[model samples]
Target: MKDVYLFSGFLGSGKTSMLTDVIRQLKEKNLKPAVMMNELGKLPFDSQVVEKDIPLKEMLEGCICCSGAEKTEAQIQSLLLDSNFDVLIIETTGAAHPVEALDAVYSPLFADQLNVKGIVTVVDTKLWLHRQTLTPQVRSLFMEQIRHAHLLLANKMDLLTEAEQGQAVYELQGLNPHAFILQTTNGRVPLNLLEDLKATAQVAKKEIIKAPLSAMQLGSCLVEFTGKEFTQEQFEEWVRTLPDTVYRMKGYVPIEGIKNPMLFQYAYGMVQWLPEYLKMPAKLVMIGENIDTVPVIGFN
Candidate 1:
């Protein structure tokens, strides 16, 4: 098993900028590292900005925790089988929930090959208050990312007044009483502070990560159904009727006589699907206001 670190944070929380720094720091010590980036509806163009030559995997168009679990697992397997990287870092979508994503990683299939190193959550102090003021659905989604994090990184400290910084730290501690709080100007934290390394017991000297991961990205409720297969027409109709609150929905579902699990993505007020993957059983994760209240497909 190799060391695995998961970076959990909301959108615009500096996960990408921090990843570049972490990769360089890891290479400075001669460690082989790989990166997995999750983005919404597109490839992580940010990968183009990474100066390092590390191997990168893109789990695009959906959150790994809910609808994209299988794709994510497949990518992870490919990385471990094809590459010689000693460390794996997964940067989740900002809206993704950390709990479900972790479950997919620690599942029996990969448990023997991968070890849990840490769950590092980076937060932007400048936007934290603004996000908090959004609807409860949005707020839950935002707070969920930090609630169960091992470390609550209060990034962008330079933008806040001393009193504001103290208040921000207080809020984080109030949510996750056990997390280690450190203020950062731009996601500038030591990689050593991330997780314990078994190859080097000396690295275990610090105990920063301990909190467990929890369910993911907010404003969404996950809906998965496998009892019956769907006709192509039925599937399309179901997607079209999705309520307005369904901001994003994606997952795999079995199709009648198709023999392939259909992969569907709905975001930006449009829908797209690929029949090639055909990884089915219809697992959908919907992120938006009142996902539980949406009566589109009636999963409740």
Candidate 2:
């Protein structure tokens, strides 16, 4: 049977970094790994992180838990038939609910051929300490991700002070007493720790995800800034005025006087900019609750 590991975490919680390390470790042990990445927008930005030699399938413009349920099953089946891999790793979009994502994977079509290892969630330690600042719906989403994880990685420990880190761990342990919690920086964890993990008991009982996904109320929109270049200062100012509901935004953006577009990422109130050598589409995909209502002007 092929082992399946589901990586669940909030936006900017280091899921991709963890995935890269896991893939590298698995390769060292002579185990082939296949990846399935889900993104909330038309562009598959994160998929670029996966190397070309790895077998990768991407689902875009939707989350696997709801709109892409059927597609998720199809992709899994495709990977099983076409790839010679010992393990399959699924990286769900940040907005995905853990229960619904597992529900999508429990399809009977090829259930007998797969063994679900466990859900490994990456928690941003500093973000958890300040989760109360988020909207009630988003905060509930964040807690649900932690509450359902079988193995939790409290990531980004470097950003937290000793006192704050202790408080975060205490609360995370209280939320998930059954799971093993590891404090990590950059989502680093020992691979041996994952070898014996079994899917949570909650996964064995699948009734929880039967409710309609509309109840979650998350949304996303893709804004293409094709042919437009903005001054770096202008773009940053616009981002500053956005509402708290805007959880994450990422894409290649063209900046005035720059030879190539820059890779831009925004989560919570923090923004990161990386220089990109290759020219790509100048578009941004935003994900959050009621994100469609978030305004975009001047650079359409």
Candidate 3:
């Protein structure tokens, strides 16, 4: 059986950057590994960065829950059959619920083939306080990601002061007393934190939090596209048209003339782009609650 590590965090928490570094460290230790990325958007930026050296696969279009439990199990089985990797690393989307992601991995189909070694939850020190002020749905997502993690990586520590860092750690501890909390910069926790971890003797059951009626009233629609090329300007215009209700959008796109694919990330109304070479075919995934895909694709 292969060891599986789940890496999860909220938007801009540096999960990818940290995972990339971890892969490099694993290589130095002579460990063969494979990565699975659950990207919210069409582009696979995280996958591209690691694919150059490690075998990488991606699950796009929605969160692990959106794919339903069975499909995720099949995907894991297929990846194991296709590769000789000793470890499997899954990077969940920023808005993902880690508990749900974990539950999916424990599905009967993958239980015998994959062993979950640990969960490393990356926390953005700078955003932790502010996130509490957001809607309950958003807050729940962030908390659930940290709650059951075996290693709570309080990342982006450089952004916080000594007092702020201490307070953040304190709060995280309150949320998950069993997790080993560590301060890190850019998601750089030591590799030993995961090196020898074995899945809990029995998979720990996860607590399910039902969305309140008001929260359930808000819904999201996800659309995915796979193609060879996209115009940079058009992509920007298309994303700009997203409605306010569209809380997050992420993915990668290979620009027509640019040498590297562009990573697109949007949260609330903030947007960021990172340009890098494409290690796989071009794809885009968009997530918008109560929004239509017509304008999103039309812009491209």
Per-model C-alpha lDDT, please?
0.68, 0.79, 0.67
Roughly what TM-score does model 2 have, to 2 decimal places? 0.67
Q: How do the residues 1-300 of candidate 1 rate in per-residue lDDT, one tens digit apiece?
A: 678888889888898888888888898899988988888867668777655578888877788887787788788888888888988989888888776665445432344466656568899888886775678886787787787576778999999899999999998888877567779977887877775322111111112121122321123334545456777677778767766745565666567787766776676478787885534445555544334445644332
Of 1 and 3, the candidate ahead on lDDT is 1
Off by over 4 Å in 1: 197-300
Candidate 3 Cα errors over 4 Å, as ranges: 202-300
Model 3 Cα lDDT, one tens digit per residue, 231-278 = 867766776776675555555567787775676656667778887565
lDDT of 3: 0.67
lDDT of each residue in 124-213, candidate 2, tens digit only: 999899999999999999998998787899999999889998999999999877678999998897888887775522111212111111
Task: State how far residue 286 of model 3 sits from its true place (Å).
Answer: 32
Q: How does residue 81 of candidate 2 score in lDDT? A: 88
Q: What RMSD does each model have against the real structure? A: 10.4, 15.8, 14.9
Best by lDDT: 2
